[model samples]
Target: MSPPPAVWVSGLRKAYASHLALAGVDLAIPEGEFFGLLGPNGAGKSTLINILAGMVHRSSGRAEIFGFDVERDFRRSRQMLGVVPQELAYDPFFTVREFLRLQSGYFGLRHNDDWIDELMAELDLADKADANLRSLSGGMKRRVLIAQALVHRPPVVVLDEPTAGVDVELRQGLWRFMRRYNQEGHTVILTTHYLEEAEELCSRIGILQRGRLIALDAKDHLLARFTWRVLTVTFDKDPGPLPETLAGFLSGAGENTLVLRLDQSRHSLGAVLTALQDLPAQILDLHVQEPDLEDAFTDILGNMGLEQP
Candidate 1:
């Protein structure tokens, strides 16, 4: 038999006084999958996450966590989930170790120094365990948030821009740790504006726009939907002239190079090379860049052009 789904939502809806935040959203996240929730600002990414965290009341819909209804089994739902919120909200008076201890206590977990020590060491917070929250850097504080969330070892973990304001080294460390948890059978749901991270880490992705679920599928499938490719042709010297046919495909001409955005289905790379023939300069190099998650994100939201809420 298949393992239970970590999360399930059907016909989910949420509304404010004059606006709807989510409209008939439906999604199911299988256990142990790294899922990405991607969208521009005000695209209902946070709203969906809020509903899952039970921080927001839904107008209509059903949400289940580990087969427990969120509305009816609030305690169980909350117990099975850990959320690292986007914002930094922590008590400055507590030390890093103290904070995790307190958070675990809220879940009725007794003090477990071994677990706390392991978490601190794994998150690189061992040296800072005795330091006050106010004494740590922003990235360190973010680690504290993650440590607090994992104190009870919830089956599902939600990270909302956990890398925001974090340094590159810390970001890499965080991703590696998240991957370890995912491999160990913990479901991870990530929401971020960083598309590159999503492309690199998530196996599946969901794109939201204007409170609507625009796209949801495996990462490769989502990228396959965007077939536009970019070719860069570099010249030893500045090309003094251009072909008339090349003008249509040329996106821009930079210093000693020309960039073309071509639909790969209709025009092949050979065709692009043929169009660049007879230029007044020798070819320095050729580079091809494929569409990434950021490209898909722009294409989707640019198509919607929704007004702000």
Candidate 2:
């Protein structure tokens, strides 16, 4: 039989008292695929990741890593999966190298010094290898967390907001390192609030709303699904209130500029210009911005009764 998907979950559910954290969520990510999981603060993104990491017990359903069931085959599944959590949690007593070594030892990797050195070196943590975890800065702690997760060279890696609060340079470096490992045949599952980062790195995107999978498709398909465009018009003079026909489409307004949100299937650009003819003000400039991942994301969230941020 062919090897199972790198990561698979079926009918996953997690309940805490009356509130349901994850409601029958099913996901399958193939090996070497760069997958993105996106959701708002309480969208169960963290709950799902915790379940897969074996940190939280699932209320119902199956979760597997490389075909190994997470619960029954916990050892194998956990060993093959590495997670860089959002929390900057670590043992204050241990140094960077010592912490990584302890993490490696958890998987019966008694002699992982060579790989440990490589991880620290690649992550630019060699200089701080002997520094106590508590003494390191937040950025350095994040790097050490990544190193610990990767110490055993797992085939599947889950990055839960790995770049949260980090500087742009560090964030860029993190992506480069992740991309390099992903190209080396490692499956990468990224969960972040940053839609743009997900848009650039992930081939497949899955969005979760209040305990539900709201959208799942390739990045391009998701973008193409929403047929909308934003048009910004600059008037040479102060154009008072716009015509009724164009007023409804107005999404933004400035001193002498107006931005219109147009559903291409329903509103035509010609209609916008025709309505604007009623104004005596001359058109200084006009620009049309195409819909991107953010637009699609907002549309999805808005339709589900939640305001998109």
Candidate 3:
């Protein structure tokens, strides 16, 4: 038989006073998949993560990790998952090495020094291993938090805004390590506002909006469904005024430039160029911008009648 999904949710719901944080959401992430969970602020992404991490109780329905029910088999489920939370919380007195060792002990692990050391090195925290948490920079502390979550070697890893407040160097380092880790068959669930990062890493993506799972599909499929290409035209001199037919497709404008949204099914680059020929603008340069994950995300949210960021 096929192995159970690395993570599963069914009819999950969470309520706070009169507000519903999660409204009957369902998701299934296969083992070894790199999945991205994206949503706007006040969406249920964090609430759902908190529920799976056993930090918050769900109002109804179920969550499971590797077929272990989150509520009934809490211990086993928790043991199989490692979560790097968005908040920066740590004991100021503890050194980086001490923190990870303590975290491993919390999961009933003993003699975990080797794994702890490896994690520190992987995260570029080896040089700061003996440094106290209070003395570390924000980015360094974030790396330590990631190490702490992985010290126990859980099969499933959840990273909630892991690269937030981190510098480009650290962010790149973390991505490299995570990519390698995920390629080794460990499941990774990431939630990030960096749509580009999600586009590069995640195989599948789930979009949450106002407590509902609005869209879920392979990354490419999602982009194909709602994203459109953009054609940017630059003129050598003033284009006078755009012709009526060509002006209809104008999505944006810059000094001597016009941006047009193109749907593959309805319009082609050849057609756009042909229409531009009749205009007074002498095309100095033309560029085609392919659709990306950010466009897909905005399109999805807009379709759902939510305010797009």
lDDT of 3 by residue, 1-309 (tens): 998999999999999997999999999999999999999998999999999999999999999999999888999999999999999988998999888888989999989998888888788889998999999889988988888888888899999999988889989999999999999999999999999989989999999999999999999899878546889999987676777767778899889888998777777778779878777768999898998999899888887789754
What order do candidates take by lDDT, descending?
Answer: 2, 3, 1
TM-score: model 3 vs. ground truth: 0.94
What's the true lDDT of residue 52 in model 1?
89
Q: Candidate 3: which pairs clash? A: none
RMSD of 2: 2.7
Query: Which stretches of model 1 miss by more than 4 angstroms?
Result: 238-247, 274-277, 307-309
**How well does candidate 1 score on lDDT at residue 186?**
94
Tell me the TM-score of model 2: 0.89
- Per-residue CA lDDT of model 1 for 1-309, tens digit only, reads 776699999999999998888998999999999999987788788999999889998999998899888878999999999999999888988999888888888998887778999999999999999999999989889998998888899999999999998989999999999999999999999998789999988999998876788889999988898878898999999987788867788888899999988888888878678767678888889999999988777777677775322
For model 2, the stretches where C-alpha displacement exceeds 4 angstroms are 239-252, 264-284, 307-309
**Of the pair 1 and 2, which is ahead by TM-score?**
1
- Which scores better on TM-score, 1 or 3? 3
Model 3 stretches astray by more than 4 angstroms:
241-245, 275-281
lDDT scores in order: 0.89, 0.92, 0.91
